[model samples]
Target chain A: MASLHSAVLDLRRLELMANGDSTIHRLDARAKVLVTLVFIICVVSYTRYELAALFPFFIFPVVMVSLTGIPPLFIIGKLALLCPFVLAMGLFNPVFDREILVQLGTLGISGGWISFASILTRSILTVGTAFILVGTTGFTAVCRALERLGMPQVFAVQLLFLYRYIFVLTEESGRASRARELRSCGKKGLGIRSFGSMTGHLLLRTWQRAERVHMAMLARGFSGEFRTHHVSRFGWAEITFITVWSGLLIFMRIFNIPHLLGALLAGSIS
Target chain B: MSHHIVQVKGLRHIYPDGTIALQEVSFLIHHGESVAIIGANGAGKSTLLQHLNGYLTPTAGDINIGDFPLTRATLPDIRRTVGMVFQDPDDQLFMPTVFDDVAFGPLNLGLSGSILEQRVEECLSRVGAAHLRDKPPYHLSGGEKKRVAIATVLAMSPDILVMDEPTSGLDPHARRQLLALLKDFSHTKIFTSHDLDMVFELCERTIILHEGLVKADGPTREIFNNADLLAECCLEKPFSMQNCAACGRPKTGL
Candidate 1:
């Protein structure tokens, strides 16, 4: 229960970070959103053997984190929580494919190892770019950007509502858990027997709450759609931001900057 | 004759599972009158409030708000006419920022640009929440959230305001502030609350509900002064009345 409470608090802290007036935060949400999308597409478009090429892609998220004053450790910590799933997805690769692809001094590297590394890199870059997007633009602004970019209004509203109610749901469940703990004494009273009923009660409460919310929405003249004051205009700065970032992303995608830099360094050393 | 801004007749609501939430409830609220509905839990105050905005179609009765009948065709006008402030501020303030939430209703009415911004700003300032314009609803304090919730409804310029448990879960200071704010609103107000003191302070009339029925309804003073009726409805006397009784002062009629 305590950990759940802190997790919600951490989410709130991340949102508060978006309220800062840093350069990255000041960039229009449309710009940040478009750039992040381009960055992700470029990162994921890399071939399996192109691990070195993915390293320079890290610059987008790193620069975002630094410029926005979002803590590197916090973003890394969030990524760490998701690492197990990414690791699991690629863990069996080395055993499945044993074809040697390259030699590293005295050791042979297989295609499986290279692909596995590529998967990990892709996950990090994509997830990191997503975090930077949210950290810099905030969730609401991102939703507005999505709507402006021609995403369906219903989807944008659904995303906003989901984010809004997640806290309410978490708090309700936390209170329920606390009540259970207080009465259970030694945790003996709460087992699978009670868990089903507890979850059932939670669902019932959520349904009733949702109904009330719908009533509130109806009272406010919410017909079939949601209306907001968020009118995002694509100004020159936003266009410039998108143009510069997309061009850079395309250039990075076409030519492997890490491989080129490595070759140049190797040549200069020789 | 005083015009009835809201009229509900033979109102009954049955849940899909067959639980009778409300039955045979009827009431008339006149223009510019402030009324408070008091009841125990499950007394169907919330169900009755939902009917006013045509959110919950009464299983057996009719509701008329101003000239609009509570029906599918008139739902939009009914909603616009009767602004509802929900018990939970979280549910009401669904938008990301205070400004957006306040502007939601007005924007739906097709107000745009400076006019929309001005309406939102006016409501926020009316509730003393203009400072929180840019803040997300989740970031607000409980009292601030309540104020913003009221602003969200007020921006619509409704003829009648319905609030469910407006003062629930609020601290004494917040409750006092809310009471002060509610006092300033000129709209025909209908509120459901367990706060008898607030009822005594703000409402001129009171309706008590029990077992899904209109158990009693009258002037607030008369309702609160009737100790026997209060006991029957599972309600306590307002704190001030109890304090007056404690001091051996005879209860005086207002």
Candidate 2:
């Protein structure tokens, strides 16, 4: 019961995230995608041993959250939940063969730690960037961007159809599950037997819905390609904003500034 | 008389599972003519409409539109010439905004820049949907969505317009508005509708389909006057409309 309530709440939060009004949401989708991509690349390129140096990279995430009005807690919480998978894959490296590579003031960190840290960092940064992009740009805008970027029209139309009908299938599945639960009197609890039947019924419903949707498309003058008229223009502000973020990322990579800054500050303080 | 824009000869369509939706259907739609296909549910009305636009291939017959054969290679041309307005606006308007939905067809035909924008604007205005251009389709009222759906095909500038259940679920005012708009179009029209009153007022010809077969096809007045034929097709003559003083005198055949 508690889990269901939480799930509903999570869905609402995601809806809010997707529909939020902020500067990030207002930017052209191309600018947002490019910035997010650059941010991911910079985060991934950092050497694993430079843990303290990586702290400055948090600025990118923080700025994104504050400007986009996305809840910091929500982004961090989602990333934290995904951490276990990265940890599991990397944990095996330490257990299989232990090889100490570096000694930092009488404490030894092995070669496995480097790889583990890389995995963890990459996972957090990639997922965080993806979440921000989708939350800010919305599905339709992302699709439009992809279309403008010269993706095949057939594939674009297919994606649009998939997005349009996914909800119908989910609603059907929800009703079927409720019916099963009501009949089962809470004992069976949607086990494999009923689940199989529910899935099959959903597939049939989807098939029927697809036919209707295709007919509808044909009626609307859809021949082979899906076309839309949502125009996007990269204003001067959007261009500069994207340029600055990309330039910073590129500069950081070229000069190794994150590492040098941390080392300089540490040497002066100690 | 204008040349026949749509010529379907012995058209038959049997579903893969062997459910025959259309059998031996024959019809001719002349240019600038408005015809209605009417019957009760499961009457193969939609199946025949799909065949007109080359959406569904016939099992054992031919459909020719303005000298263009309904073959796989000629589908694009057929679609450009014959615009189809489906029953459900939700399925037809797949784009996020009304403007996008209306502009879909024109864009597919590779119309870009100011010309595409001009056509989209004109189409929206034609359907009286210009007010809702930027609004998302999911937020539209049913009538508004239907209008946008109509605009989407209108943007294609097809020579023949085929609509499926155009007035279904519309309020009387919206239905009247749609009927008026459709009446103004010079293109050939083939529509399936349950609104008998609208059909009688707007269509010069009516085709009655029953159980995947054409039961009656002729002048609208002649078909409406045949009470026994109407009863067999599960259709009732619009007595209220017939008796309405505003609609004026009854025609000779009815």
Candidate 3:
């Protein structure tokens, strides 16, 4: 519960951070979206046991975080919450592929461990890029960007509604948590039964709210068509932003930068 | 035709679960008039209001906006003519920012470019919310959200304004400002609220709905004055109309 509470608060900060007037925020959302997509694709395409090459990809999110002036701790905290899901997927890798792949002075590391570490690294890098995308360009702007970039209008509308109502969901959940705390005789813990019923009630309430919002949209001349009126256009800056970022991302994808740099340092020392 | 003339005759609405929300509810509201529909909980105020814009099709009878009846074909046109402010502003302001929400209706009507920008700005300024344009709805106060929600509707330039409990969740000052804004709109205004005081002050006519029925419909003053009728509908007079709590006599205006 505490983790979920902090998660909501931190995620809300992403929306606030998106409103910042930094260079990253000023870039068109479509540009950021495409850059982040290219970054993710690069990160995800690495071989299962490849690890060192993924290290350079961390620069993308780091640069965005610094340029946007969004606190690194916030994004790290958000990423840490999802790390366990990646952990579950990678934990079994070490058990299945146990062949020794690398040797230190006195210790050996197996292929499974390397693959597991690689999986974890790729997941974090890809997910971190997405977080940066949303942190710099808001969810709505991203939806608009997706729509303008040839995504089906219906899907973009769905994403918009989902992003818009997440606040309402958190608020309703917060209120429900407060009410439960108030009645629990100074006990802050939520019981399993209460959690069960609370989740059911929240679902029902969210469903009803969705219906009401749909009616409100219908009342305001909505005829199943969502029109994007954001005046932000694709221009030279956006073109440059995408070209530079995608070029860098694809360059890093093709060449193992850390490996090449390490070899250069080793040869210079020789 | 100037804006909107709402005429409902024997309108009935039944939920899928066999709950008859409205039964034979009828009213005629001319353009440029302010009317209030006040009732207790479960009295069908919301169901009746939903019919005005074709949000919910009436189980029986008809609703006419200007010259056309509320039908599937006319739903779009009537929705354009009648703007609805929902009970919860959060439900209406679903856009990412106040500006987007205000522009949602006008953009749907195909008014883009500078005309759309001007429409959005005009509506936001009308609601005294131009300063809040770039802010997201989640950041707004209750009153600001309400103002922006109304601005969303006003951007459409509807002839008839229909609101469901417009002032329900507002503070006193917010309520006061909303009433002042409502008074400024020259087109037809319709509201369903438990705030009888607002009805007495803003609306000239009041309709009392009781158990899916129009218990009474007449001048606002007369309806409030009828203590017997008010009691039958399980309602009380507005605080402004009730005798002074500390004093022995009715208020000065009465």
lDDT of each: 0.84, 0.78, 0.86
Off by over 4 Å in 1: A16-28, A186-188, A266-270, B1-4, B111-114, B243-254
- Give the DockQ (2 decimals) of all models: 0.62, 0.30, 0.64
- Segments in model 2 whose C-alpha atoms lie over 4 Å from true places: A1-35, A45-54, A61-124, A131-168, A171-192, A215-244, A250-262, B1-4, B239-254
Model 2: how far is A14 from its true place, Å? 9.8
Least well predicted 10-residue stretch by lDDT in candidate 2 chain B: B238-247
Best-first order by DockQ: 3, 1, 2
Task: Flag the better candidate by DockQ, 1 or 3.
Answer: 3
* The candidate that achieves the highest lDDT relative to the unseen native structure: 3
lDDT of 1 by residue, A140-246 (tens): 78887888789998899889778867776787789888888889997668577889999999888877777667777778887666554545466887888888878
| Candidate 3 local lDDT, A32-116, one digit each (tens) | 9888888888888888889999998888888888888988888788878888898998889899998998999779999999999
Q: State the lDDT at A256 in candidate 3.
A: 92
* lDDT digits (tens) for residues B185-242 of candidate 1: 8889999999988999999999999989999989999989899999998998997777
Candidate 3, which segments miss by more than 4 Å at Cα?
Answer: A1-6, A26-28, A95-97, A186-190, A194-196, B1-3
Tell me which residue pairs clash in candidate 3.
none
Q: All candidates' TM-scores?
A: 0.89, 0.76, 0.92
Best by DockQ: 3
